[model samples]
Target: MKTPATPPNEAERLLSLRQSGLLEFDNRQPYDRLTRLAKRLFNVSVAMVNLIDERTQIAKSVDGAVPAVLPRSVSFCGHTILQPEPLVVNDARDDSRFVDNPLVAHENGVRFYAGIPLRLPDGAVVGSFCVVDQTPRDFSAQDLAALSDLAALAEDEFAASCAATTDELTGLINRRGFNQFAAFALSGARRRAEPLTLAWMDLDRFKQINDRFGHSEGDEALKAMANLLRSAFRETDLLVRYGGDEFAVLFADTDEQGAWIAMQYLTEQVAKFNQTGSHPWTLTFSWGICEFDHHHGDLEQWLKEADRKMFSMKQKNSAAR
Candidate 1:
Protein backbone atom coordinates (compact mmCIF):
# COMPACT_ATOMS: atom_id res chain seq x y z
CA MET A 1 0.00 0.00 0.00
CA LYS A 2 2.96 2.32 0.54
CA THR A 3 4.01 4.37 -2.47
CA PRO A 4 7.37 2.95 -3.44
CA ALA A 5 10.02 5.58 -3.88
CA THR A 6 13.14 5.06 -5.93
CA PRO A 7 16.02 3.34 -4.17
CA PRO A 8 19.38 5.09 -3.68
CA ASN A 9 20.93 3.14 -6.53
CA GLU A 10 17.92 3.38 -8.79
CA ALA A 11 20.06 4.28 -11.77
CA GLU A 12 22.41 1.31 -11.29
CA ARG A 13 19.55 -1.09 -10.50
CA LEU A 14 17.72 -0.03 -13.65
CA LEU A 15 20.90 -0.40 -15.68
CA SER A 16 21.32 -3.91 -14.27
CA LEU A 17 17.74 -4.68 -15.30
CA ARG A 18 18.29 -3.35 -18.81
CA GLN A 19 21.56 -5.25 -19.29
CA SER A 20 19.72 -8.53 -18.61
CA GLY A 21 18.11 -8.15 -22.08
CA LEU A 22 14.80 -9.24 -20.57
CA LEU A 23 12.50 -6.32 -21.39
CA GLU A 24 12.59 -6.71 -25.16
CA PHE A 25 12.82 -10.47 -24.99
CA ASP A 26 9.52 -12.33 -25.45
CA ASN A 27 8.19 -14.54 -22.65
CA ARG A 28 10.76 -17.30 -22.31
CA GLN A 29 10.06 -20.78 -20.95
CA PRO A 30 12.25 -20.92 -17.85
CA TYR A 31 10.61 -17.76 -16.50
CA ASP A 32 7.10 -18.82 -17.55
CA ARG A 33 7.54 -22.27 -16.00
CA LEU A 34 8.52 -20.74 -12.67
CA THR A 35 5.49 -18.48 -12.61
CA ARG A 36 3.22 -21.41 -13.39
CA LEU A 37 4.69 -23.37 -10.51
CA ALA A 38 4.40 -20.39 -8.20
CA LYS A 39 0.73 -19.92 -9.10
CA ARG A 40 -0.19 -23.53 -8.42
CA LEU A 41 1.91 -23.88 -5.30
CA PHE A 42 0.48 -20.74 -3.77
CA ASN A 43 -3.03 -21.51 -4.98
CA VAL A 44 -3.22 -18.01 -6.41
CA SER A 45 -5.04 -16.88 -9.53
CA VAL A 46 -1.97 -15.07 -10.76
CA ALA A 47 1.79 -15.48 -10.51
CA MET A 48 4.30 -13.24 -12.21
CA VAL A 49 7.95 -12.52 -12.73
CA ASN A 50 7.95 -8.76 -12.95
CA LEU A 51 10.73 -6.27 -13.67
CA ILE A 52 10.25 -2.68 -12.66
CA ASP A 53 11.58 -0.33 -15.32
CA GLU A 54 11.68 3.50 -15.07
CA ARG A 55 7.94 4.06 -15.30
CA THR A 56 6.38 0.66 -15.71
CA GLN A 57 6.43 -2.79 -14.13
CA ILE A 58 6.94 -5.28 -16.96
CA ALA A 59 5.66 -8.80 -16.45
CA LYS A 60 8.32 -11.06 -17.88
CA SER A 61 6.09 -14.06 -17.19
CA VAL A 62 2.54 -14.33 -15.97
CA ASP A 63 0.10 -17.14 -15.21
CA GLY A 64 -3.09 -15.12 -15.05
CA ALA A 65 -4.87 -12.03 -16.47
CA VAL A 66 -2.33 -9.45 -15.34
CA PRO A 67 -1.34 -7.06 -18.12
CA ALA A 68 2.13 -7.21 -19.66
CA VAL A 69 2.86 -3.70 -18.34
CA LEU A 70 1.43 -1.90 -15.33
CA PRO A 71 2.08 1.63 -14.15
CA ARG A 72 4.77 1.61 -11.45
CA SER A 73 2.51 3.78 -9.29
CA VAL A 74 -0.11 1.04 -9.12
CA SER A 75 2.30 -1.87 -8.84
CA PHE A 76 2.52 -3.76 -5.57
CA CYS A 77 5.74 -5.20 -6.93
CA GLY A 78 7.15 -1.69 -6.80
CA HIS A 79 6.80 -1.67 -3.03
CA THR A 80 7.98 -5.26 -2.93
CA ILE A 81 11.44 -4.39 -4.29
CA LEU A 82 12.08 -1.84 -1.54
CA GLN A 83 13.14 -4.52 0.91
CA PRO A 84 15.34 -7.57 0.85
CA GLU A 85 12.55 -9.86 2.17
CA PRO A 86 9.21 -10.91 0.78
CA LEU A 87 6.21 -8.57 1.07
CA VAL A 88 2.90 -10.19 1.94
CA VAL A 89 -0.54 -8.73 2.15
CA ASN A 90 -2.97 -11.28 3.61
CA ASP A 91 -5.89 -8.93 3.07
CA ALA A 92 -5.40 -5.71 1.09
CA ARG A 93 -8.55 -4.14 2.53
CA ASP A 94 -6.97 -4.36 5.99
CA ASP A 95 -3.80 -2.55 4.97
CA SER A 96 -4.09 1.24 4.66
CA ARG A 97 -1.63 1.31 1.78
CA PHE A 98 -3.89 -0.81 -0.49
CA VAL A 99 -7.33 -0.32 0.94
CA ASP A 100 -8.10 2.38 -1.62
CA ASN A 101 -5.78 1.24 -4.37
CA PRO A 102 -7.61 0.51 -7.59
CA LEU A 103 -6.30 -3.05 -7.67
CA VAL A 104 -7.87 -3.64 -4.27
CA ALA A 105 -10.97 -1.43 -4.44
CA HIS A 106 -11.96 -2.58 -7.91
CA GLU A 107 -14.11 -5.65 -8.55
CA ASN A 108 -11.12 -7.89 -9.28
CA GLY A 109 -9.85 -7.35 -5.78
CA VAL A 110 -6.28 -8.29 -4.97
CA ARG A 111 -6.97 -9.56 -1.46
CA PHE A 112 -3.91 -11.70 -0.94
CA TYR A 113 -0.54 -10.81 -2.40
CA ALA A 114 2.99 -11.95 -1.71
CA GLY A 115 6.13 -10.84 -3.50
CA ILE A 116 9.85 -11.39 -3.06
CA PRO A 117 12.44 -9.13 -4.60
CA LEU A 118 14.31 -10.50 -7.59
CA ARG A 119 17.86 -9.45 -6.84
CA LEU A 120 20.78 -9.60 -9.23
CA PRO A 121 24.16 -10.82 -8.01
CA ASP A 122 25.30 -7.21 -8.04
CA GLY A 123 22.77 -6.55 -5.23
CA ALA A 124 20.33 -4.76 -7.46
CA VAL A 125 16.63 -5.43 -6.96
CA VAL A 126 15.22 -5.23 -10.45
CA GLY A 127 11.75 -6.61 -9.80
CA SER A 128 9.69 -9.18 -7.98
CA PHE A 129 8.59 -12.80 -8.13
CA CYS A 130 5.04 -12.57 -6.88
CA VAL A 131 1.64 -14.28 -6.53
CA VAL A 132 -1.78 -12.68 -6.23
CA ASP A 133 -5.31 -13.85 -5.50
CA GLN A 134 -8.75 -12.20 -5.61
CA THR A 135 -9.91 -13.84 -2.42
CA PRO A 136 -8.47 -12.94 0.95
CA ARG A 137 -6.16 -15.57 2.46
CA ASP A 138 -3.40 -15.78 5.02
CA PHE A 139 0.06 -17.05 4.05
CA SER A 140 1.94 -19.21 6.53
CA ALA A 141 5.69 -19.11 7.20
CA GLN A 142 6.04 -22.16 4.98
CA ASP A 143 4.33 -20.28 2.16
CA LEU A 144 6.78 -17.36 2.43
CA ALA A 145 9.73 -19.75 2.41
CA ALA A 146 8.39 -21.50 -0.68
CA LEU A 147 7.93 -18.17 -2.44
CA SER A 148 11.49 -17.24 -1.52
CA ASP A 149 12.78 -20.50 -3.01
CA LEU A 150 10.94 -19.86 -6.26
CA ALA A 151 12.41 -16.38 -6.29
CA ALA A 152 15.83 -17.93 -5.87
CA LEU A 153 15.20 -20.09 -8.94
CA ALA A 154 14.25 -16.94 -10.84
CA GLU A 155 17.50 -15.31 -9.69
CA ASP A 156 19.40 -18.38 -10.86
CA GLU A 157 18.02 -17.89 -14.34
CA PHE A 158 19.13 -14.24 -14.28
CA ALA A 159 22.59 -15.22 -13.07
CA ALA A 160 22.98 -17.86 -15.80
CA SER A 161 22.11 -15.46 -18.60
CA CYS A 162 24.12 -12.69 -16.96
CA ALA A 163 27.17 -14.95 -16.79
CA ALA A 164 27.32 -15.05 -20.57
CA THR A 165 27.70 -11.26 -20.68
CA THR A 166 29.60 -10.82 -17.44
CA ASP A 167 33.30 -10.78 -16.77
CA GLU A 168 34.17 -13.72 -14.51
CA LEU A 169 36.70 -11.76 -12.46
CA THR A 170 34.80 -8.57 -11.64
CA GLY A 171 31.16 -9.45 -12.31
CA LEU A 172 30.88 -6.40 -14.57
CA ILE A 173 29.48 -6.76 -18.05
CA ASN A 174 32.09 -8.04 -20.52
CA ARG A 175 32.80 -6.53 -23.92
CA ARG A 176 30.70 -9.10 -25.78
CA GLY A 177 27.71 -8.48 -23.56
CA PHE A 178 28.20 -4.75 -23.87
CA ASN A 179 28.14 -4.98 -27.65
CA GLN A 180 24.96 -7.05 -27.52
CA PHE A 181 23.01 -4.78 -25.17
CA ALA A 182 24.54 -1.37 -25.88
CA ALA A 183 23.03 -1.17 -29.35
CA PHE A 184 19.53 -1.70 -27.99
CA ALA A 185 20.14 0.80 -25.17
CA LEU A 186 21.47 3.39 -27.61
CA SER A 187 18.46 2.93 -29.85
CA GLY A 188 16.15 3.62 -26.93
CA ALA A 189 18.11 6.77 -25.98
CA ARG A 190 17.93 8.06 -29.55
CA ARG A 191 14.21 7.48 -29.71
CA ARG A 192 13.72 9.51 -26.57
CA ALA A 193 16.12 12.31 -27.67
CA GLU A 194 18.13 11.84 -24.51
CA PRO A 195 21.77 12.77 -24.08
CA LEU A 196 24.18 9.88 -23.72
CA THR A 197 27.75 10.06 -22.39
CA LEU A 198 30.39 7.37 -22.67
CA ALA A 199 33.24 7.32 -20.20
CA TRP A 200 36.24 5.25 -21.21
CA MET A 201 38.60 4.68 -18.29
CA ASP A 202 41.84 2.92 -17.42
CA LEU A 203 43.35 2.34 -14.04
CA ASP A 204 46.53 4.19 -13.27
CA ARG A 205 49.48 1.95 -12.39
CA PHE A 206 47.42 -1.26 -12.39
CA LYS A 207 50.38 -3.25 -13.72
CA GLN A 208 52.49 -1.99 -10.85
CA ILE A 209 50.10 -3.63 -8.41
CA ASN A 210 50.43 -6.98 -10.18
CA ASP A 211 54.20 -6.71 -10.25
CA ARG A 212 54.49 -5.75 -6.59
CA PHE A 213 51.64 -7.73 -5.04
CA GLY A 214 51.04 -10.73 -7.37
CA HIS A 215 48.22 -11.84 -9.71
CA SER A 216 45.92 -12.52 -6.77
CA GLU A 217 46.31 -8.94 -5.56
CA GLY A 218 45.85 -7.63 -9.10
CA ASP A 219 42.52 -9.47 -9.31
CA GLU A 220 41.51 -8.00 -5.99
CA ALA A 221 42.30 -4.51 -7.25
CA LEU A 222 40.12 -5.05 -10.30
CA LYS A 223 37.24 -6.20 -8.15
CA ALA A 224 37.73 -3.40 -5.68
CA MET A 225 37.69 -0.85 -8.46
CA ALA A 226 34.61 -2.43 -10.03
CA ASN A 227 32.79 -2.17 -6.72
CA LEU A 228 33.73 1.48 -6.47
CA LEU A 229 32.50 2.20 -9.99
CA ARG A 230 29.25 0.39 -9.27
CA SER A 231 28.59 2.47 -6.19
CA ALA A 232 29.64 5.77 -7.79
CA PHE A 233 27.63 5.68 -11.01
CA ARG A 234 23.92 5.71 -11.71
CA GLU A 235 22.08 2.40 -12.22
CA THR A 236 21.22 3.74 -15.66
CA ASP A 237 24.89 3.83 -16.65
CA LEU A 238 26.26 0.83 -18.56
CA LEU A 239 29.39 -0.10 -16.61
CA VAL A 240 31.56 -2.69 -18.32
CA ARG A 241 34.88 -4.38 -17.75
CA TYR A 242 36.15 -3.55 -21.21
CA GLY A 243 39.31 -5.57 -20.52
CA GLY A 244 42.15 -5.88 -18.06
CA ASP A 245 42.74 -2.61 -16.19
CA GLU A 246 40.19 -0.87 -18.42
CA PHE A 247 36.47 -0.16 -17.98
CA ALA A 248 33.74 1.77 -19.76
CA VAL A 249 30.48 3.40 -18.66
CA LEU A 250 27.71 4.64 -20.88
CA PHE A 251 25.63 7.28 -19.10
CA ALA A 252 22.14 7.75 -20.53
CA ASP A 253 20.10 10.97 -20.51
CA THR A 254 23.11 12.94 -19.31
CA ASP A 255 24.71 15.90 -21.05
CA GLU A 256 28.37 16.94 -20.91
CA GLN A 257 27.84 18.98 -17.74
CA GLY A 258 26.05 16.13 -16.07
CA ALA A 259 28.79 13.73 -17.09
CA TRP A 260 31.37 16.07 -15.56
CA ILE A 261 29.44 16.09 -12.31
CA ALA A 262 29.38 12.30 -12.26
CA MET A 263 33.12 12.16 -12.83
CA GLN A 264 33.64 14.56 -9.94
CA TYR A 265 31.51 12.33 -7.76
CA LEU A 266 33.77 9.38 -8.59
CA THR A 267 36.83 11.38 -7.63
CA GLU A 268 35.34 12.06 -4.21
CA GLN A 269 34.35 8.42 -3.82
CA VAL A 270 37.90 7.21 -4.61
CA ALA A 271 39.33 9.61 -2.09
CA LYS A 272 36.94 8.25 0.53
CA PHE A 273 37.73 4.69 -0.48
CA ASN A 274 41.45 5.31 -0.04
CA GLN A 275 40.77 6.56 3.45
CA THR A 276 38.95 3.30 4.25
CA GLY A 277 42.20 1.29 4.01
CA SER A 278 40.25 -1.55 2.39
CA HIS A 279 43.11 -2.19 -0.02
CA PRO A 280 46.87 -2.25 0.52
CA TRP A 281 47.42 -0.20 -2.64
CA THR A 282 45.65 2.97 -3.63
CA LEU A 283 43.60 2.91 -6.87
CA THR A 284 43.27 5.74 -9.36
CA PHE A 285 41.73 5.99 -12.85
CA SER A 286 42.00 8.26 -15.86
CA TRP A 287 38.87 8.64 -17.93
CA GLY A 288 37.48 10.39 -21.02
CA ILE A 289 33.86 11.27 -21.70
CA CYS A 290 32.22 11.18 -25.14
CA GLU A 291 28.80 12.70 -25.48
CA PHE A 292 26.59 11.03 -28.05
CA ASP A 293 26.65 12.87 -31.35
CA HIS A 294 23.95 12.42 -33.94
CA HIS A 295 26.52 13.09 -36.66
CA HIS A 296 28.61 10.00 -35.81
CA GLY A 297 25.77 7.48 -36.31
CA ASP A 298 28.25 4.79 -35.34
CA LEU A 299 28.85 3.35 -31.88
CA GLU A 300 32.34 2.22 -32.77
CA GLN A 301 33.30 5.68 -33.91
CA TRP A 302 31.92 7.22 -30.73
CA LEU A 303 33.83 4.73 -28.60
CA LYS A 304 37.00 5.49 -30.55
CA GLU A 305 36.63 9.15 -29.64
CA ALA A 306 36.30 8.24 -26.00
CA ASP A 307 39.34 5.99 -26.28
CA ARG A 308 41.35 8.83 -27.72
CA LYS A 309 40.33 11.16 -24.92
CA MET A 310 41.09 8.53 -22.29
CA PHE A 311 44.57 8.02 -23.64
CA SER A 312 45.15 11.75 -23.46
CA MET A 313 44.16 11.81 -19.80
CA LYS A 314 46.29 8.80 -18.97
CA GLN A 315 49.27 10.43 -20.60
CA LYS A 316 48.68 13.59 -18.60
CA ASN A 317 48.43 11.60 -15.37
CA SER A 318 51.67 9.77 -16.15
CA ALA A 319 53.44 13.05 -16.79
CA ALA A 320 52.15 14.46 -13.47
CA ARG A 321 53.33 11.39 -11.59
Candidate 2:
Protein backbone atom coordinates (compact mmCIF):
# COMPACT_ATOMS: atom_id res chain seq x y z
CA MET A 1 0.00 0.00 0.00
CA LYS A 2 1.24 3.46 -0.83
CA THR A 3 1.72 5.81 2.09
CA PRO A 4 -0.12 9.10 1.97
CA ALA A 5 1.84 12.14 0.80
CA THR A 6 3.14 14.18 3.74
CA PRO A 7 1.07 17.33 4.34
CA PRO A 8 2.81 20.62 3.56
CA ASN A 9 3.81 23.09 6.33
CA GLU A 10 2.94 20.46 8.94
CA ALA A 11 3.40 22.65 12.04
CA GLU A 12 1.43 25.58 10.71
CA ARG A 13 -1.21 23.17 9.54
CA LEU A 14 -1.48 21.55 12.97
CA LEU A 15 -1.96 24.89 14.65
CA SER A 16 -4.59 25.76 12.10
CA LEU A 17 -6.40 22.44 12.60
CA ARG A 18 -6.42 22.80 16.40
CA GLN A 19 -8.66 25.83 16.08
CA SER A 20 -12.20 25.26 17.45
CA GLY A 21 -13.49 28.80 17.56
CA LEU A 22 -16.67 28.31 15.59
CA LEU A 23 -17.32 25.00 17.33
CA GLU A 24 -18.07 26.94 20.49
CA PHE A 25 -20.30 29.44 18.70
CA ASP A 26 -23.69 30.02 20.27
CA ASN A 27 -26.42 29.21 17.76
CA ARG A 28 -28.47 32.30 18.62
CA GLN A 29 -31.18 34.07 16.70
CA PRO A 30 -28.99 36.96 15.60
CA TYR A 31 -26.47 34.62 13.97
CA ASP A 32 -29.37 32.92 12.23
CA ARG A 33 -30.82 36.25 11.15
CA LEU A 34 -27.58 37.31 9.48
CA THR A 35 -27.16 34.16 7.41
CA ARG A 36 -30.85 34.23 6.47
CA LEU A 37 -30.36 37.75 5.19
CA ALA A 38 -27.42 36.63 3.08
CA LYS A 39 -29.47 33.84 1.50
CA ARG A 40 -32.44 36.09 0.73
CA LEU A 41 -30.28 38.96 -0.50
CA PHE A 42 -28.34 36.66 -2.82
CA ASN A 43 -31.54 34.85 -3.88
CA VAL A 44 -30.30 31.47 -2.66
CA SER A 45 -32.08 28.53 -1.03
CA VAL A 46 -29.53 28.12 1.82
CA ALA A 47 -26.76 29.96 3.61
CA MET A 48 -24.07 29.07 6.12
CA VAL A 49 -21.16 30.74 7.86
CA ASN A 50 -18.68 27.89 7.90
CA LEU A 51 -15.53 27.71 9.98
CA ILE A 52 -13.09 25.40 8.23
CA ASP A 53 -10.38 23.76 10.28
CA GLU A 54 -7.95 20.97 9.38
CA ARG A 55 -10.41 18.08 9.59
CA THR A 56 -13.95 19.46 9.76
CA GLN A 57 -16.05 22.32 8.45
CA ILE A 58 -18.23 23.61 11.26
CA ALA A 59 -21.39 25.58 10.57
CA LYS A 60 -21.15 28.18 13.30
CA SER A 61 -23.84 30.49 11.91
CA VAL A 62 -26.28 28.83 9.56
CA ASP A 63 -29.69 29.82 8.28
CA GLY A 64 -32.11 27.83 6.12
CA ALA A 65 -29.72 24.86 6.23
CA VAL A 66 -29.00 21.40 7.53
CA PRO A 67 -28.01 20.93 11.19
CA ALA A 68 -24.60 19.33 10.75
CA VAL A 69 -20.90 19.54 9.99
CA LEU A 70 -19.87 18.77 6.43
CA PRO A 71 -16.62 16.95 5.75
CA ARG A 72 -13.84 19.46 5.16
CA SER A 73 -12.70 18.08 1.82
CA VAL A 74 -16.21 18.09 0.34
CA SER A 75 -17.34 21.51 1.56
CA PHE A 76 -17.22 24.35 -0.97
CA CYS A 77 -16.01 26.68 1.81
CA GLY A 78 -12.73 24.77 2.00
CA HIS A 79 -11.79 26.07 -1.43
CA THR A 80 -11.63 29.63 -0.10
CA ILE A 81 -8.43 28.69 1.71
CA LEU A 82 -6.75 28.51 -1.70
CA GLN A 83 -8.18 31.65 -3.27
CA PRO A 84 -7.89 35.44 -2.93
CA GLU A 85 -11.43 36.61 -3.73
CA PRO A 86 -14.90 35.13 -3.76
CA LEU A 87 -15.23 31.55 -5.10
CA VAL A 88 -18.36 31.21 -7.19
CA VAL A 89 -19.49 27.82 -8.49
CA ASN A 90 -22.49 28.45 -10.73
CA ASP A 91 -23.00 24.72 -11.20
CA ALA A 92 -21.26 22.03 -9.12
CA ARG A 93 -22.14 19.30 -11.62
CA ASP A 94 -20.25 21.18 -14.30
CA ASP A 95 -17.21 22.14 -12.16
CA SER A 96 -14.36 19.65 -12.16
CA ARG A 97 -13.57 20.13 -8.44
CA PHE A 98 -17.18 19.78 -7.33
CA VAL A 99 -18.21 17.05 -9.77
CA ASP A 100 -16.89 14.16 -7.64
CA ASN A 101 -17.88 15.71 -4.30
CA PRO A 102 -20.61 13.74 -2.53
CA LEU A 103 -22.50 16.86 -1.56
CA VAL A 104 -22.85 17.70 -5.23
CA ALA A 105 -23.94 14.20 -6.12
CA HIS A 106 -26.68 13.84 -3.51
CA GLU A 107 -26.79 15.75 -0.23
CA ASN A 108 -28.22 19.34 -0.04
CA GLY A 109 -28.44 19.34 -3.87
CA VAL A 110 -25.78 22.00 -3.82
CA ARG A 111 -25.84 23.29 -7.42
CA PHE A 112 -24.32 26.69 -6.63
CA TYR A 113 -21.95 28.11 -3.98
CA ALA A 114 -20.21 31.41 -3.21
CA GLY A 115 -17.60 31.58 -0.47
CA ILE A 116 -15.49 34.54 0.60
CA PRO A 117 -12.28 34.00 2.57
CA LEU A 118 -12.13 34.47 6.35
CA ARG A 119 -8.99 34.75 8.47
CA LEU A 120 -7.75 34.27 12.00
CA PRO A 121 -5.72 36.90 13.88
CA ASP A 122 -2.51 35.25 12.68
CA GLY A 123 -3.74 35.93 9.10
CA ALA A 124 -4.44 32.31 8.31
CA VAL A 125 -7.54 31.55 6.22
CA VAL A 126 -9.62 29.47 8.61
CA GLY A 127 -13.18 29.65 7.38
CA SER A 128 -15.59 31.21 4.87
CA PHE A 129 -18.72 33.31 4.64
CA CYS A 130 -20.66 31.30 2.08
CA VAL A 131 -24.14 30.97 0.66
CA VAL A 132 -25.33 27.71 -0.90
CA ASP A 133 -28.32 26.80 -3.03
CA GLN A 134 -30.08 23.75 -4.45
CA THR A 135 -30.54 25.36 -7.88
CA PRO A 136 -27.76 27.05 -9.82
CA ARG A 137 -27.87 30.77 -9.06
CA ASP A 138 -25.81 33.58 -10.57
CA PHE A 139 -24.35 36.04 -8.04
CA SER A 140 -24.32 39.67 -9.01
CA ALA A 141 -21.17 41.66 -8.29
CA GLN A 142 -23.32 43.38 -5.65
CA ASP A 143 -24.01 40.13 -3.79
CA LEU A 144 -20.33 39.23 -3.90
CA ALA A 145 -19.40 42.64 -2.47
CA ALA A 146 -21.84 42.36 0.44
CA LEU A 147 -20.59 38.87 1.39
CA SER A 148 -17.05 40.21 1.49
CA ASP A 149 -18.11 42.76 4.12
CA LEU A 150 -19.68 40.05 6.29
CA ALA A 151 -16.61 37.83 5.85
CA ALA A 152 -14.42 40.41 7.56
CA LEU A 153 -16.71 40.49 10.60
CA ALA A 154 -16.58 36.69 10.89
CA GLU A 155 -12.78 36.86 10.70
CA ASP A 156 -12.72 38.87 13.93
CA GLU A 157 -14.21 35.97 15.88
CA PHE A 158 -12.05 33.48 14.00
CA ALA A 159 -8.99 35.29 15.31
CA ALA A 160 -10.22 34.98 18.89
CA SER A 161 -10.27 31.17 18.61
CA CYS A 162 -6.47 31.14 18.43
CA ALA A 163 -6.29 32.04 22.11
CA ALA A 164 -9.34 30.05 23.17
CA THR A 165 -7.27 27.40 24.96
CA THR A 166 -5.58 29.72 27.45
CA ASP A 167 -5.99 28.92 31.13
CA GLU A 168 -6.88 31.81 33.43
CA LEU A 169 -4.83 30.33 36.28
CA THR A 170 -1.39 30.88 34.78
CA GLY A 171 -2.26 32.04 31.27
CA LEU A 172 -1.32 28.54 30.19
CA ILE A 173 -3.57 26.19 28.24
CA ASN A 174 -6.12 24.32 30.33
CA ARG A 175 -6.34 20.50 30.38
CA ARG A 176 -9.27 20.22 28.00
CA GLY A 177 -7.69 22.43 25.31
CA PHE A 178 -4.13 21.12 25.55
CA ASN A 179 -4.98 17.59 24.44
CA GLN A 180 -5.62 18.75 20.87
CA PHE A 181 -2.50 20.92 20.95
CA ALA A 182 -0.34 18.12 22.29
CA ALA A 183 -1.55 15.61 19.72
CA PHE A 184 -0.97 17.99 16.84
CA ALA A 185 2.51 18.76 18.16
CA LEU A 186 3.35 15.07 18.29
CA SER A 187 2.09 14.52 14.76
CA GLY A 188 4.32 17.27 13.45
CA ALA A 189 7.38 15.90 15.24
CA ARG A 190 6.75 12.45 13.82
CA ARG A 191 6.25 13.75 10.27
CA ARG A 192 9.40 15.82 10.18
CA ALA A 193 11.71 13.14 11.62
CA GLU A 194 12.20 15.50 14.57
CA PRO A 195 11.66 14.82 18.27
CA LEU A 196 8.84 15.80 20.64
CA THR A 197 8.32 15.04 24.33
CA LEU A 198 5.29 14.38 26.43
CA ALA A 199 6.42 15.59 29.84
CA TRP A 200 4.35 14.73 32.92
CA MET A 201 5.10 16.30 36.31
CA ASP A 202 3.61 15.50 39.70
CA LEU A 203 4.45 17.17 42.98
CA ASP A 204 5.95 14.45 45.14
CA ARG A 205 3.73 13.64 48.11
CA PHE A 206 1.83 16.96 47.94
CA LYS A 207 -1.07 15.69 50.02
CA GLN A 208 0.89 15.98 53.27
CA ILE A 209 1.21 19.75 52.83
CA ASN A 210 -2.51 20.21 52.09
CA ASP A 211 -3.29 17.95 55.08
CA ARG A 212 -0.96 19.86 57.40
CA PHE A 213 -1.28 23.50 56.16
CA GLY A 214 -4.97 23.47 55.03
CA HIS A 215 -6.61 23.79 51.58
CA SER A 216 -6.04 27.57 51.40
CA GLU A 217 -2.33 27.02 51.61
CA GLY A 218 -2.66 24.29 49.05
CA ASP A 219 -4.31 26.75 46.66
CA GLU A 220 -1.44 29.17 47.22
CA ALA A 221 1.06 26.45 46.43
CA LEU A 222 -0.79 25.59 43.21
CA LYS A 223 -0.76 29.24 42.17
CA ALA A 224 2.92 29.47 42.98
CA MET A 225 3.63 26.37 40.91
CA ALA A 226 1.62 27.82 38.07
CA ASN A 227 3.79 30.93 38.11
CA LEU A 228 6.93 28.86 38.24
CA LEU A 229 5.81 26.67 35.39
CA ARG A 230 5.00 29.72 33.31
CA SER A 231 8.42 31.19 33.94
CA ALA A 232 10.26 27.94 33.33
CA PHE A 233 8.80 27.30 29.88
CA ARG A 234 8.43 29.10 26.58
CA GLU A 235 5.16 30.85 25.65
CA THR A 236 4.55 28.48 22.73
CA ASP A 237 4.61 25.41 24.99
CA LEU A 238 1.47 23.95 26.59
CA LEU A 239 1.16 23.41 30.38
CA VAL A 240 -1.96 21.92 31.88
CA ARG A 241 -2.91 20.74 35.35
CA TYR A 242 -3.77 17.06 35.13
CA GLY A 243 -5.69 17.81 38.29
CA GLY A 244 -4.60 17.33 41.94
CA ASP A 245 -0.83 17.35 42.28
CA GLU A 246 -0.03 16.54 38.65
CA PHE A 247 0.54 18.71 35.60
CA ALA A 248 1.53 17.83 32.03
CA VAL A 249 3.52 19.76 29.44
CA LEU A 250 3.99 18.97 25.81
CA PHE A 251 7.38 20.13 24.55
CA ALA A 252 6.51 20.65 20.96
CA ASP A 253 9.39 20.72 18.52
CA THR A 254 11.82 19.29 21.07
CA ASP A 255 13.87 16.10 21.29
CA GLU A 256 14.44 13.54 24.08
CA GLN A 257 17.89 15.05 24.89
CA GLY A 258 16.55 18.59 25.10
CA ALA A 259 13.42 17.56 27.02
CA TRP A 260 15.53 15.77 29.64
CA ILE A 261 17.58 18.92 30.22
CA ALA A 262 14.34 20.92 30.68
CA MET A 263 13.05 18.24 33.05
CA GLN A 264 16.07 18.78 35.32
CA TYR A 265 15.34 22.50 35.37
CA LEU A 266 11.77 21.85 36.51
CA THR A 267 12.92 19.47 39.23
CA GLU A 268 15.36 22.00 40.66
CA GLN A 269 12.75 24.75 40.99
CA VAL A 270 10.22 22.41 42.56
CA ALA A 271 12.91 21.37 45.06
CA LYS A 272 13.68 25.00 45.83
CA PHE A 273 9.99 25.65 46.49
CA ASN A 274 9.92 22.72 48.91
CA GLN A 275 13.02 23.98 50.74
CA THR A 276 12.03 27.63 51.10
CA GLY A 277 8.36 27.16 52.04
CA SER A 278 7.39 27.21 55.72
CA HIS A 279 5.86 23.75 55.59
CA PRO A 280 7.65 20.74 57.00
CA TRP A 281 8.78 19.80 53.49
CA THR A 282 9.10 21.55 50.16
CA LEU A 283 7.47 20.37 46.91
CA THR A 284 9.39 18.13 44.55
CA PHE A 285 8.22 16.35 41.38
CA SER A 286 8.73 13.15 39.41
CA TRP A 287 8.69 13.68 35.66
CA GLY A 288 8.76 11.47 32.55
CA ILE A 289 9.67 12.65 29.06
CA CYS A 290 8.70 10.58 26.05
CA GLU A 291 9.83 11.41 22.53
CA PHE A 292 6.94 11.02 20.12
CA ASP A 293 6.46 8.24 17.55
CA HIS A 294 3.76 7.61 14.96
CA HIS A 295 3.31 4.10 16.38
CA HIS A 296 2.47 5.22 19.92
CA GLY A 297 -1.19 4.64 19.04
CA ASP A 298 -3.72 7.24 20.19
CA LEU A 299 -3.27 10.11 22.65
CA GLU A 300 -4.32 8.09 25.70
CA GLN A 301 -1.94 5.26 24.99
CA TRP A 302 1.01 7.56 24.37
CA LEU A 303 0.37 9.37 27.67
CA LYS A 304 0.11 6.06 29.50
CA GLU A 305 3.44 4.92 28.13
CA ALA A 306 5.05 8.17 29.31
CA ASP A 307 3.41 7.88 32.75
CA ARG A 308 4.68 4.33 33.19
CA LYS A 309 8.21 5.39 32.37
CA MET A 310 7.96 8.30 34.81
CA PHE A 311 6.69 6.00 37.56
CA SER A 312 9.54 3.60 36.91
CA MET A 313 12.09 6.41 37.15
CA LYS A 314 10.48 7.70 40.34
CA GLN A 315 10.60 4.26 41.95
CA LYS A 316 14.26 3.88 41.02
CA ASN A 317 15.12 7.27 42.52
CA SER A 318 13.30 6.42 45.75
CA ALA A 319 15.12 3.08 45.98
CA ALA A 320 18.52 4.69 45.38
CA ARG A 321 18.10 6.96 48.40
TM-score of each: 0.55, 0.50
Q: For all the candidates, what are their Cα RMSDs to the real structure?
A: 17.6, 11.8
lDDT of each: 0.87, 0.71
Worst 10 residues of 1 by lDDT: 19-28
lDDT at 8 for candidate 2? 53
**C-alpha lDDT of candidate 1 relative to the true structure:** 0.87
lDDT of 2 by residue, 54-122 (tens): 667788788875655877766777677666678998998888877777777886678998998776676
Q: Model 1, stretches more than 4 Å misplaced?
A: 166-176, 179-321
What's the residue-level lDDT of 216 in candidate 1? 90
Evaluated with lDDT, which candidate comes out highest? 1
Best by TM-score: 1
- Against the correct fold, how does model 2 do in TM-score? 0.50
